[model samples]
Target: MTKPQIVWLRRDLRIEDQAALRAAAEAGPVIPVFVLDDETPGERRLGSASRWWLHGSLQELGDALNARGSRLILRRGSAAQVVSLLADEVGAGAIHTIRHYEPWWVKAEQDIAKRVDLVLHDGNYLLPPGCVVTGAGTPYRIFTPFYRAAMAHMPPPAPTSAPHFHAPARWPASDRLDDWKLRPTRPDWATGFVEVWTPGEAGATERLKDFLDVAAEYETTRNLPSQEGSSRLSPHLHWGEISPATVWHALDGRQGKGSESFRSELFWRDFAQNVITQFPDYPDRSFRPEFEKFRWRDPAKDENAKADLKAWRQGRTGYPIVDAGMRQLWRTGWMHNRVRMIAASFLIKHLLIDWRSGERWFWDTLVDADYGNNATNWQWVSGSGVDAALFTRIMAPLTQSAKFDAAEYIREWVPELADLTDEDIHDPPNRPRGYPDQLIGHREARERALSGYRAMKAS
Candidate 1:
C-alpha cells in the first residue's frame, strides 16, 4: 500500500505547471489541501477584495480536483498546526509546496518543516526571490541593474505538464468552502467584480491568449486606461492560478515591442518580490531609512486632512483622472497602472498624506493587492524606497491625464465629466456641476510638498 503524499496549497492554486503539485502526485497517491491560516499574518491577512477572488479561485480549484478523481481538503486554522495534523492523519510520506516570499508564509514554512519531510519548489515567480543578485552577492537595490541581471537568467524553466494523481484507497475528511465565509453578503460591492474578472486557471489561460493576440500594440496602448491593452493577469498571477513560468514560455520567441515591454513589466514584478524577500518589513515601512524623517499629514489629527482622504477614497477629488481611477478601483476591484501612479501621487504628494494610508486602502480594495508589489510600488511613488522617485518629482495629475489621453477613461468612471470636450476633459475650464472643487491648487501643493521634503533633509 502506497502512503499518501500531501500537497499543501497556498497561493499556487492551479494544477498545470504547478511544481509542488506535480512533485507530490509523482510520489504516490496525492492529497491536496488548502489551509485558511489567518493567524500567521494577523493584520496582513487577506483583505475583503482578495477574499472575494480567493472564494472563486478555490471553488474552481475544487471542481478541477474533483474531475481528476480527487478533491481539495479545505481546513481553517493556523497553517503550521493544520498541515502538521493533516500529514499525521494521512500518514503521509512527504509534503510538497511552492516557495512563498510573504513574511508570514516564511514563518509558516519554518514551523511546518519540523513535523514532516517538506519539499519546497519554485512556481510563484519566474525565478524565486533571492536567486538573482549583484556580482557582490547582495540583492540589487535598483530596478535597472536588477532587470538586466534577472533577464540574463532569462526565460524561466520550461513549464511542466499537469500531473495525474493516483488516489488513495479512501479520501481524507474535508471542510465545506462556504462555511469559511470568504465572500461578502451584507452589501455586495463586488457585484461589478464578477463582470470584470474571472478568477480561475481556465480564465487566466484565456486572458493570456487574448492578450498575446494584441500584445504587439501593448507599448503604445497600455498607458491609455480606456483600452484593453493589458493582460489583466495580475489577480490570476497573484493567486498563482497561472504561473509566471507559463506566461514567460507563452510569450517565448514572440517578437514585438509590446511583447518586450510586457516582459519587462514581468521583470518588475519579480523585482518587487526580490525587494520584499530581503526587506521583510517592506510592507509597513520605508526601504530607505532616511524617509522616516519625512513629514506626512495624518487624517486622524487634522480635519482637513481627514476630508481630503475621504474625497480621495470616494472619487470626488475633483481631479478628473485621479477621481476616475479611485472610482474604477471602487467599482471593479482593479485600476489601470498609469492611473494608479497618478492617484497615488496625488494622495502622497498633492494631499501631503502618508503613502501608508493609500497603501492600506489599496491593500483592502485591489483584487491583485500583493504585499510585495503594493508596498514596493507605493514606496516608489512616495520616494521612500530604494532607487525611488525623487521627492521633488511630484507628478502633475492634470498633465498626466492629458499626456496619457485618459479622457475616455474619465468619462466612463467620472460621469459628471462626460459632457466635457476631449480638450477640456483633463482640466475643465470651470468645475462641472456635482463635481467637488479641487482640494488644493497645484502650485501651492507642490511648494508645500517641496518644503516638507526640505525640512526632512535639514532635520
Candidate 2:
C-alpha cells in the first residue's frame, strides 16, 4: 500500500505558502479535503456575506489545485465523520492541517485526532497563542504587555513555497462547488463585495505585493477611509489564503516606521488570539468577570433605545462621521480600522447599546471577522475589555471626523453630504430632507453611557 497523508485545507486556503500542504507532501502522496460542517455548537454560523465570499474563494482554490495536478474533495456534514471516512477512502494514515484556536474548531480537531494521526501546524497566527507570557508564566490581559511578549517569541517560520510532484492517490468524488449555493440566491446584496474584492490565494499575493510597493507611505495614509493605502489582505488572511508569516517575511528586510507600525498590527492579531485561547467564551461574554453585571442599555424594550440603534445602523445617527463609517460598512463588506473604532465607540458609548449587538452586526457583515480581533476591538471601544478606556471617556464621532479630516470618506459613503462644507459635514447644520434627525442627542447619550458605566463599576 502506498503511504498517504491527508492535507485538510481549512482557512489556510493557498497552495503556495501552505505549511500543511508542504508537510503532507513531504510525508507521502497527499489528499486534499475541505469539509463544511454547519452543526458547530456554542458558536454562530457564517453569515450571508461570509457564505458568498467562501463560495468564490473555494472555487479559486479548486482551480489552483487543479493546475497543480491535484483536486480538492468537498464534503458536507459532521467534520470528524467526514475526515474519518476520507481517511478510510484514501487509505490515509495521517491528517495534516493548520491549527485553529476557535473553540468549536478546537473540539472538532480533538475528536478527529483520537481516531487518526492528526498533525497540526501553526499556520494561521504569526505566533502561537499561549507561547508568549509574562515571566510569571501567566497570560497578559493588557495588549501592550501581550504584544511585547508575542514579539519576543521567535518570528514565525518563513512562508512555505508550493510543493512539487505531489499528486493525489485518486480523485475522490467532490460535491460540486456550485451545489453548496454559498452565494446569494435572491435579493443579491453582494454586488459591493464583487466590486470591492478578488477572492483567493492568487488575489492575496497581488494585494500584498501592491501594499509593499507603497509601504513607506502606509503609516500616514492608512487612516483615510477612502485611500487605497491599506494592504486589503484581511479577507485573504481571514480565509487563510495568505498567512501572517507570509506578510511578516515580506516586510522583514525593511527598516522604517512603516514596517514597525505594520508589524504592530500583526502583533495585535496575535494578542487577540492569545486572549481568545485563554478565554474561549470571550466573544459572547466579558473577559473581566465584573462586566457580567454591567447594566448594558437595552434597545429592544425601550423605544428611544430601539430608535437610537436603528439610526446608528441605518446611517442616520445625525453624526456625519459615525454615519459615514456605518454606511461604508453597509456598502462594502469592510471598514477602515480607524472608522471601525469611531463607529464602535459611537454605538457603545454614544448610543449606549450593548457591544454584543454591534459585534454580531460586524460578525455578520465583515469579510475579515476573526473572533479574537472582532471581540476584543468591540470591548476595547466600549470600555469593557481588560485594559479598556475609561467609560467616562466618550468619543464624539463629529469631533473625531474633524480631527481625522474624514470628509472625503464621508462624501464617498454618504453622497447626501457631498455638497456640505467639511466643517458642516462632521456635524450637520440641519437635518437633510432624505436623512433622519438625531435619534439621541450626543451630549445626553454621553451622560447616559457614563452613568451606566458608573453603575457597572459600582457593582
TM-score of candidate 1 to 2 decimals: 0.98
Models, CA RMSD each: 1.0, 1.6
Candidate 1, residue 75: how far the Cα is off, in Å = 0.3
Tens-place lDDT per residue, model 2, 1-459, is 557788887778888778789888888887888988787743567866678778888999999888888878899887778988889888896999999888888998999898888999887888778786788989888988787777766577877789964675566778998898888768787788888889998889889999999787788878877677778888898899988989998997898988788888877777788878888887788766777787776887898888788788878887777788888777778888889998998888877788899999898888888788899888887777876876678877777788878988889888888898877887778866786677678888888877887788898
> Which consecutive 10 residues in model 1 have the weakest lDDT in total?
286-295
Q: Candidates' lDDT values, in order?
A: 0.91, 0.82
> What is the Cα-based lDDT of residue 197 in candidate 1?
90
| Pairs of residues at least 3 apart in sequence or in different chains that clash in candidate 1 | none
